[model samples]
Target: MISRGIQSNKVNGTFYPTSFILVGIPGLEGAYKWVGAIVCLCYVLALLGNMILVTVISASSGLHKPMFIFLSMLASNDALLSTSIAPQMLLVFWFQKRYIHFESCILQMFFLYSFTSFESGLLFGMSFDRYFAICQPLRYGSIMTNTIIVKLVIFLLLRAVTLFSPCIIFIRRFPAFRSNIVNHSYCEHMTIVKLAAADIRISSALGVAEAFMILGVDLLFILVSYCAIFHAVFSLPSKDARLKTFNTCIPHMCVFLSFHGLAFFTCLSHRYGGKRIPPFVHIILADTYLLVPPMLNPIIYGVKTKLIREKVWKALHKCQSPHVK
Candidate 1:
């Protein structure tokens, strides 16, 4: 398979593999079925949970507020992110179809990273919404108008595309690859770049720069926003008022920590824990970073946000007692 792919792309003078082999969980070949089953479950839960959130938020007029609107955007991004990685992963795990076309690999990398950037931007926007709602309650509505929200969403989409499009060019410029086998599950940027025979320092540096640009900047803003929010919460006149206000920020905080925590840990493991961490462990962490947040975000918001909780309960009740009309 590898020889054929290399030969086909060696037309004319240049060399590029037509397809790459995906070694899913390097040493866990015997347990591919079990792993695939678990992955399939997570994918389903992610899709189902995110889709439900989007549907409920869209169907109800009460959820037309800025907070819920940002949440629906987050849900949609989660669904897209999971869809980009999980199906290809399942194909490799279940059917032993481990070969991915070069073009498909590049497309997968684009969507995966782009949606990740979208999630980061959405979380940052949600933090901004919380900041105004708590610290500047009087101006919250005016500041977070529908027009502003629409503009913010557009900016995030454009920013992600404009920033990450360079990755495609970087990958395309590789003259040849050291090997046609990718050690990880999906077509991750670093994993694919590492396969190139040429010096990967530029690609690696760009990946690091992009990470700091997107994740680091967004995290700093979110932390600053929360600090200001907490200060305002504590200054409230009554304990109940402080508690009530702080509760509103809980769901966002949980989601922020989960997404960024897994992301940072996975990235660190990949970069620094090469000797200490097993290859499969790195793969698992990467999968968790992609899978856990999407599976957990809707649940966190559904339970912590009062309106969403009430709406979900009402939905379940209607389903259970269909004849009650």
Candidate 2:
């Protein structure tokens, strides 16, 4: 019974909404303030942790290796990804400001997906760095030089931008919307696409294709890289040498598991959990997936890597010394 392109807001032949309403978590309206506080705490932690990692890496010339460079990139991306979602989410939760401008929603959707793609690409590149360092030590220098790293990063940025640009265009082209009420906290792609009264098969299909292309392919390559790395480690003649080589890979492997494990769980729950799981639970899981990784990655790296641990302690000591004065 809904009219197409005939709402109070219309432009040309399309139903152009000025804003969209975001219902933070259905069935949990009473706890909005509590949830807002928790989300704010998590955002602060993620931002501080990631920025510390970036600063440490940049200030220490000793950490200028290819692996550290990739870690810096990952940290920067995590900070960005979390920043893109948390402020808007807090606004909805805290101030009863549930409405987001249409242009802002599109921009949020673009950044949310683009940073995710960048993370996958950076992780894949880190795996390659590991493969070369462990499996081909002598040529690692020649293969992963500064020039090569810059080129790889440039490629990752371009790939993410190219792949997600169409999403913005497609969202703008919808002729009408069933409603402007988005069910989740942020302007997630599928949620936005579902609002269209017109067919969304193309958008849905592109989303699937993009997910497989980025996550599936990158995951496959990482697994292959680790397999070869493990094989090389096991074949080493001495236990000490093998142990040393394997230790270097442990942090990267842990990070890879954390990011991908949460991602797959979120994806599967949405796709198959139908009536078994509550909607609020799914939204919490999605939010956790974005927040937890940023907070955890730097902790994992700082603790596991001896040099980084030393640098962090030194920095802490220096700060305390200034306070004592």
Candidate 3:
């Protein structure tokens, strides 16, 4: 039979070890399959949920306000995030055609990074929104105006693109080797760079640096923002008002923990000494970052965000209702 599979890129002599390759395969196979299913599910829900969010928040006159603008932005960002990885991931897992065109791979990496960064940025934005609503309720309206929201959205898009652009440029320009197979299910930066036949020390270094850059730095910002928010919540005079404010943020906060924690620990582990850790552990942590977050976001957001549940119920009811004459 003709060779029925895509050729994978591999490390050449004196580079990474073959043992490294063997370790991740079985573990990755199972993990990717499970994660892949969840990702597919998330893509469906995210599509439905976010579209409804955009529609409901847009069509409803009461929701046509500053807070809803950011909510819509969150929905749109989640949609972009799922689009970045879910479909391609499901395909890579279900089929044996594991190869991606080099250019296409570059494009995918660009987006994967972009959307993920956008997510991180969006979470930070959400926290900021909560901060304004609770801490500076008097100024929330003026601060989160349409013009300001537009500016924030534009800034977020630009930041995500810029943060991830370097990886694409570096990889595409780097001299590639005969081995081109990427071991992971998705086009991830560190995993892809590992396939580089040429000297990739700089890329690897940046890869490590980027991990800390997001976690140590971005996470710090998130924590500080939340601290301020908590302080404001406690200082409020009415216990009922405090409870209501906290309730409003429970969904966003839950999604934030699931995604940010996984992304941070996984990437940090890989960046530090993952090469020494058994490839199975590496595979689970490394690849899971891409797969798990996309899958988890929908469930966490869908369940936690009351509006998502209501919209889903509305759609279901509408479906079950008989057609009118």
Q: Which candidate number has the best TM-score?
A: 1
Residue pairs with backbone atoms closer than 3 Å in model 2 (clashes): none
Clashes of each: 0, 0, 4
> Which 10 successive residues of model 2 have the least lDDT summed?
1-10
Candidates ranked, most accurate by TM-score first: 1, 2, 3
lDDT of 2 by residue, 1-325 (tens): 4342235765544565778899998888999999999889888988898898899999999999999999899989999999999999999999988888888999998998899889989999989998998899999999999999999999989989899888789999987876788889999887788788788888877787787788778899999999999999999999999888778778778878777777766655654577798989888887887877787878876667788889889999998885653
- Give per-residue lDDT, candidate 1, residue 161: 87
Which model is ahead, 1 or 2, in terms of TM-score?
A: 1
Which pairs clash in model 3? Answer: 8-181, 9-179, 9-180, 9-181
Off by over 4 Å in 1: 1-4, 8-15
Candidate 3 residue-wise lDDT, 1-325, digit = tens = 2122223333343232221121223456766566566667667877776776677667667567665666677677777777876677667666544656666767877887777777777777767877887788899988888888788779878977776677777887765443445566566677767776678888877776665665456667777778888888888899998887687666566667777777876666656765677756665665556555555554555555666567667767989999999
Q: Rate the local accuracy (lDDT) of all candidates.
A: 0.87, 0.85, 0.66
lDDT of 2 at 42: 82
